[model samples]
Target: MKVKVQSLDGGKPGKDIELSDEVFGVEPRADILHRVVTWQLEKRRGTARGARERSDVARTGKKFGRQKGGGTARHGDRRAPIFVGGGKAHGPRVRDFNPSLNKKVRMLGLRMALSSKARDGNLVVVDSLDVKEAKTKALKERLGTLGLGRTALVIDGDALSVGFALASSNLREINLMPAVGANVYDILNHDTLVLTRAAVEKLEARFNG
Candidate 1:
């Protein structure tokens, strides 16, 4: 598929670039996308949450009442789960949330995400992403003039320009990443995708290999 490359400062059409159909023109698979997104999010989740068990509680373990017949039932100790100050019976424990999926599935999910953006007309191609000065305001103005959405993801080549990286760092709504960091979740999270010609070439090579 061929997409017109445009200027970063102003949305002027430049030369067209060829994109691989397998990479950016495939039909999006919702199941694969969901699995990949879930995996990504789960891997980043903190596993520090824990609940104290009976043995971990500081309450007394002495017998509260007779083990025989007593009004309402026999009591064990203050650390019992029936008591208010007792530890939890089966609460959540610290454990990793990382999910493992097939490598082929992950790659396919990324392709689906890119293809979905292209099919929805939410993908924008640029000649290159660079800034004269690393000023946040200047970059914002330039992107605004280009008619980008409030939340957009910009993917650069293997090496991103220092000025462009620093300029976009302060913008909360804009996400900048190199082709290596491109993934299904980040691509689908943004409202629009801005790709440079070099980034597209890199992505094509990556998927092809």
Candidate 2:
């Protein structure tokens, strides 16, 4: 598909970019997208959550009462789950939430996400641009020119552009990421996917490989 290239000033560059059908025009697979999103979210968990079990609780091991009821419910130690301030019963534990998906499936999901964006007219291609100095104001102005508010993801294929990255870091609605660092969530969460022409090519190459 052909898309018009725009400049930072939002002016048409009098040129257009040809997007790869294999990457941006594929049929979106919702199932694959769901799996990829789930995996990405799971991998982000810290797995540090823990709850005290009966053994971990500080309490005397002596039986609080006889096993048979004596005009009251039979009771165990103070650490029993039924008691207040006692150890949690079947509570959450520290464990991995990561879900393993095949490498091919991951790639497919990424492609589907990209295609979904393209189909929805949320993807835009721009001529390669760089920021000589880290300036959030300049970045904001540039985005303003393009009429993009809300969440925006900027993808660049060149070596790390620290200035550009830093400029967009403070903008809550803007996220700067290299082509190699692009992920499923980053692509789907943003309202706009701004890609430098080179970044689009790099992404296609990476996924189509």
Candidate 3:
């Protein structure tokens, strides 16, 4: 598939760039995307800190009071639930939330995510992110002209352009990422997916090479 290349410096649209069929032409599957997203979210979950139980509490095991006719009921130890500093009756246990997914499935889901954006016309290509002025106001005007909608995810080559990065830093609706950081979740979370010319080369090479 081919996508028109644009510039962030505000100029006429440039030539079209060809996208890899294997990476940008796959049929998106809801189930596959769901699984990958689920795995990613699960990995981000923090382990629940468990509280001390009766057996875990550091208390004496000696019996409490007289077991006969002392009026009070017989008790086991200071670790019992009735005691003031006693351990909890029931508590949660620490658990690992991370889950594993097949490597092939993970890669496939990413391809489908890219393809979905391409098929939906939400994918955009840019010539470069270089700008004469790195001011936020100037960038806003140029990007607004591109019709990138409400939110966009822009991916560049190895590192982001210093000037462009500074300009777009405060724009909450615009997210920037390097080519190596591309993944399924962030790609699909945005209204538009913009790839720079250098980013396109590296992305295609990542899968083909």
Candidate 4:
């Protein structure tokens, strides 16, 4: 499909770029998109939470009460779970929360996400993205003129320019990522998608390579 390329400053229409049908024309599958998003969020989880168990408590192992004379249940050590300051019986342990998905499925999910954006007219292509300096206000105003939405993702090919990255740093709603960082989760999370000419080429190579 052919999409009109626009300038970054005023969003004036320039030339048209042809998008690969395979990458930008696939049929969107909600199930695949869901799985990919879930996997991404799961992998970002920090499994650092820890709980002290019975063996980790620093307490004496001496018996608490007489075996038969005590009216309550027989007690072993002060560190038992039944005690107030005792360790937890069954508690959460530090572990990985990352979920795994097939590489092909992940790729498919990305394509589907891109296709969905294209179908919904939320995808746009820009000639380039260059900032004279790392001025966030200027960049924000430029992006606003383009009607790129308050929350949007700007993707560029290869390495992201330092000036562009810094200019967008203060924009909490706008996220800038390299083409390699493109994923189903970010594509679907944002309200609009802005891709540079180089970014579109990189995306085509990625899926068609």
CA shift of 11, model 3, Å: 4.0
Off by over 4 Å in 4: 10-14, 55-74, 82-86
Best by TM-score: 3
lDDT tens digits, residue span 90-207, model 4: 9888997867799999999999999999999999899888766679998887888777765899999998878888888889998989999999999999999999999999999998
Candidate 1: clashing residue pairs, number:
0
For all candidates in order, the CA lDDT equals 0.89, 0.84, 0.91, 0.89
Q: Pick the candidate with the highest lDDT.
A: 3
Per-residue lDDT over 157-184 for candidate 2, one digit per residue giving the tens place of the 0 to 100 score: 9575677777878888888778998889
Q: In model 3, how large is the Cα lDDT of residue 133? A: 93
Ranking by lDDT: 3, 4, 1, 2
* Per-residue lDDT of 189 in model 1: 91
Q: All candidates' TM-scores?
A: 0.78, 0.75, 0.92, 0.82
lDDT of 1 by residue, 144-170 (tens): 866677699999999998898898899
Candidate 3, residue 124: lDDT: 87
Q: Which residue pairs collide, candidate 4?
A: none
- Residue 92, model 2: lDDT of 76
Alpha-carbon lDDT of model 2: 0.84
